[model samples]
Target: MPHSGPSASGDVTGAGKLDRDVLKVAAVVVLGSIMAILDTTVVNVALQELTVRFQTSFATIQWVSTGYMLALAAVIPVTGWASDRFGTKRLYLVALSVFLLGSVLAGLSWNIETLIGFRVLQGLGGGMLMPAGMTLLTRAAGPQRVGQVMALLGVPMLLGPIGGPILGGWLVDTVSWRWIFFINVPIGLVALVATTVFLPQDEPERADRFDFPGMLMLSPGLALLLYGVANVPGAGGVSRPEVWLPAGLGAVLVAGFVLRATRIPNPLIDLGLFRDRTFSVAVLAMAFFSVSFFGVMLLFPSYFLLVRGESALSAGLLMAPQGIGAMLTMPVAGKLADRIGPGRVILPGIVAIAAGLALFAGVGAGTAYWQLLAALFVVGLGVGAAMMPIMVAALRTLRHREVARASTATNIIQQMSGAIGSAVMSIILAGVLAAKFGVPTSQGQLAAGAALADPATHDAAAAAAADSFGTAFTWGLVFMVVSAVPAALLLRKAPLRDELVPDVVDVPVGKTVV
Candidate 1:
């Protein structure tokens, strides 16, 4: 369908109004996203179960999550070009099918090695889905509706984390660990069908040749960097050569990609996207916010299961407040940004999150449930307000043609930041535990958490573990505060009419033109 706006040669010149097609696009994308986002959190709660099932150490088992993330980062950079080459709708269906197959294989895995390999396949599918879907929605909506559309799109991102753990825990406890992966199949199928029926079909655009050199440099660099960071907990600390060597190599590769991209006419991702002031600030803010938010997400389930001796189901239920808070605020935040500007909303949102993290820093083993719930809710509100608005601001500032590159850059940055957050926080938690218990952090955390499950030593281990987690959460607070600086740099411009919907004929706010 053409944009519901004036064409360049047509007589529609005033501000463009939003149409129902934008909402339709948002709904289609959110369904696919729910499958992907839910899978991530479900696995987080299942990490401990995987360790015992596989007879492996925490260090080895963490690879399941790390590998998935690394694969996601590796594949995300090429999505911009791939979407253009294959056509977004065709690529989306293929990606969904790939993910569905990976999920089935994951459920049948005979060993940890097989499981991780299958997850990598899932990641490959997921990497394309997010950016491509975002590009499709942004194009369909135009700049005028980015904020409201982002709110609708943000639903899966917020709700998945909230619901995944609860569902994952129930399945793990009542059924089997395999069910976590198996659950994606039904959801994926539904999304695939809905998309085929509802989505607009576009002809493939003329895309440039693949940037193989750029891909080789960027993908491996990201994978290696995340790999090195993920090893920090297992290797004891950042001072270890195991942590430094791959990280150093990754830095060199990424720098090379940047230099190479500068000279090339069409790179894997357009580094030029960063030249837009709104886009740059939005990316930077999201990077900082992602590190803190994703890091804490990893920390929380373990805290509940290990430090508080809660069941996985209980821990998941406890995590619900955060998502609920986000759900409540996202629509409001989106509308506010459309009127006032993202920075105004984002600044306060960042502060609220920092305050919530501060509350976590002060938590003790015996802290009441209500206190943690309140803080989590505050954190969710901040997250809902900050995250998608920055994305909206960034996309709104770009021409419609640039939305693909913008979405790619956004996905890559968010994934890398999340990978970094999870690894760094894991290292911090492990370090604190190792120091407190006089053992390697990875081994200590696993042993202590496992020990707490036993009735005899539950109380003592809980107290000690809680202190270690509290300290690690303090570091998360620091990251959140640092994120605010970039958020503050964001421009104060409200969303404007974009060039993509030149076909849209301006209409009255409450009036519809068919």
Candidate 2:
């Protein structure tokens, strides 16, 4: 059913009339968005600390991060339904409360297993918060202001990823690793209160039965697939039974979901949305960029600390420049996107990212620190500029009723792609290390350790690791270059203003974009 309002393009009340209310609601929603995004990378800086504190193997400790990602992937498909069944405001508050509770428990965990469980809990809440927040923001702003709202929301979303490691590293060095989780408490509390008080409650529409079967098929399928992919490289490739079983099962289940969705009236994902050429292309571009961007972001901190011998705090500080570069350029990019077209802005941004990654690929063990900073800054600028445009273009043609579903789809794709990207990078890096240095089998382990105990051997191993990282960065550049092609070709060339303002339609159920 459509909403009861003037046509999406009609001026029921001028923009100024509800500007304050929209801004206030946006503030609350952006806060939740930031918290959700921060959790994605917050634990990255603490991985070394967690490994030491738990006295666990590196592979075991990796689950702390991987599990959260899998849980996030599992929960995202349900957001559109959840928001409809329970009102958006109600669901937002609940998600925030659950997130806060999970954070508190995570901080108090007794062991690695407990911490991983709590992280999953946090991811569950976080997965909902992101899509829900975008749903609310897009609805509140209407089609006219989608770009503006997205631009505002993007600040925290971009900042969170860039800032998480920096903040986490600072807390771990100065305070304790627990503080990384604890920091979300105050922010979540403020967002919860503001949401309850400020957010408008739209009347609920009657809906078809919830798609439980689709959920069963899609959720576990993605979770298991991601789990298998994440474990493959670490398990010494796909030849292992452990890798193939889950991956094969996941593939079959996903195929099952596609078959089931076709038979259902209202599938959980509304896969029909992909029928639109622009929407399909936008989603593809978003996913491709996410794979390359996230893959590189996940690699950086480890490279700094493990390869460069930088302390966690220093590494975080070095990473800060990227955020600074992004912050400096985002507003200008957003305005330019509004004036010209997202495609024009985004294409250049993609090229800049490719250039930055190419520069990073040249870094050696003895490279100057300034060169590293310069490369990161360029990448940050590119990401900051490109992201808003991609989002704006994706939602450009969506009707108000489908906006939530569209946003949810975009969020899920990005998350899944990021997870896959991280796993791919991890495998590539690990494989390079193993192939170059030889596997640490029984005899090899003894010899490698003996060599490492001597300064001469340690230096050789360190050089090999550094060289492997440079090679990984080269691969990363290749990924970015390949991703840029589709983005340039598929994105529409129309100006943002023309895209935002749709023709007025007179439909009975509220005026929606036609």
Candidate 3:
């Protein structure tokens, strides 16, 4: 559907005024974003408890994570269409309601399969919330406050991942893992009510035809690719047909989606957006950063728990310093991006990230607690500074109509990159372990059990894991460095115009243009 002028009826915030009501609406939108972001990591600390509850193998339980991620990938691309077809306010409310229902179902799930199914339901709604929230907030703020709004909105987004493990760990220890899902209920309800009361019912004038074929190709392609990566730890490398086949097919399907999108009117993704050099660079940089940062984040927790013999609660505690560092830096970095441009902010941010990864590479089973915290703090600083700038930079030249699509694309890429990074790191770690000790059972059980048995074996296994992790981190550092170079070179030296400029027509000699 095509959006009319900014003041068209049903606009979320009424024309041209920044009033208390608008702020209230924006606050509600941020709450919705928080709900989505929190779910991303809330399950991390509960994996062990879930494993026991499900009575499933580690390989099988891991699907709970993989399934949610796949569902997120599948649903994200369709959000722009959904919001446009249904009014923004209407869709936002529906999405939140669906997410709430999913959370309720998850808490009451009878088996691992049902729990995973519910998680997918949760992901479906969650996958749209951030982009939808951004749409509402940006349209309401009217561009002058994009920086401030993004900075404010980022607080919960940054806090969620950091807090998720801590919160989940505490819940599992103090109550039950079900509480983690249950916690979303009240927050979701609040957001839903606030959205209904505050959000404007902006419906687009003309509805575009849905591109079912494009979605069919892209969604499963992404899901299969991520699924393949998630299974790599247990399934081995390219040598394992099961590992390679799905990944290969996914790649082919994605290529087909790209080709099809280029020829279609109102494609699922407007590939032409990549024509803008700054947007292209920003997207690429974001993708690489996600690979490096999320790969480390996903691995570090397990490393502490398995290698250092820390309890899940202790592991969560150890990760707190990193979150603190990120929290400390994001607002300042966000403001800096506003003042000096994202290029300036991102360049140094990537450098810090690389430095942090280098420090992480030095960590071992015998590393001191303070040293681990220090490494994490450094990494968090890099993450804090890098992410917001990448987001703001990509949207700097975009119009209000384009923001949802752009945000969705950025998120999909980040998720896919993280999945790939996790897979690659897992493969490296698994192979190193097998070579150091021996191959586990066909299901990868023996390797897991051996690491749990003797301290010597555990330490040896950890060293091998650390070595592989270090190698991946080094590559991640290189990716950060390389990504920063292009971003620094391509991004605008100064901020672009903050307002959404309409497409203007060129008037030629003796020509009348609308």
Best of the candidates, TM-score: 1
lDDT of 3 by residue, 1-514 (tens): 3322243334543344556655886799888888888787877667656755776544455556655766676666666667667767787888899889999999999998899889889988887777677767766655444545666677787788678888877887788889989999999999988888888777654445867788788867876676565556566456687778888888888899999989987776779878867778888888777767765666676666656666677777778878887887877887788777888888887887788777767666577778778878887887788887887888777655566566666767677677655545544554454555566413232364357566667666667655655665666667677777767764466446445444421111111111
Q: Write the per-residue lDDT of candidate 1 for residues 366-408, one digit (tens) a residue.
A: 9988999999999999988887787776776777667756766
Models sorted by TM-score, best on top: 1, 2, 3
State which candidate, 2 or 3, has the greater lDDT.
Answer: 2
Clashes of each: 8, 1, 0
Tens-digit lDDT string for candidate 2 (263-292): 887766668888866677777788888878
After superposition, the stretches of candidate 2 with alpha carbons farther than 4 Å from their true spots are: 1-14, 17-27, 54-63, 134-154, 193-205, 338-340, 395-404, 435-458, 491-514
Q: Model 1: which residue pairs collide?
A: 4-504, 5-503, 5-504, 5-505, 6-502, 6-503, 6-504, 6-505
lDDT of 2 at 308: 70
* TM per candidate: 0.84, 0.83, 0.82
lDDT score of model 3? 0.70
Inter-residue clash pairs, candidate 2: 3-510
For each candidate in the order shown, give its overall lDDT on alpha carbons. Answer: 0.76, 0.71, 0.70
**lDDT score for residue 193 of model 3:** 84
Clash pairs, candidate 3, are: none
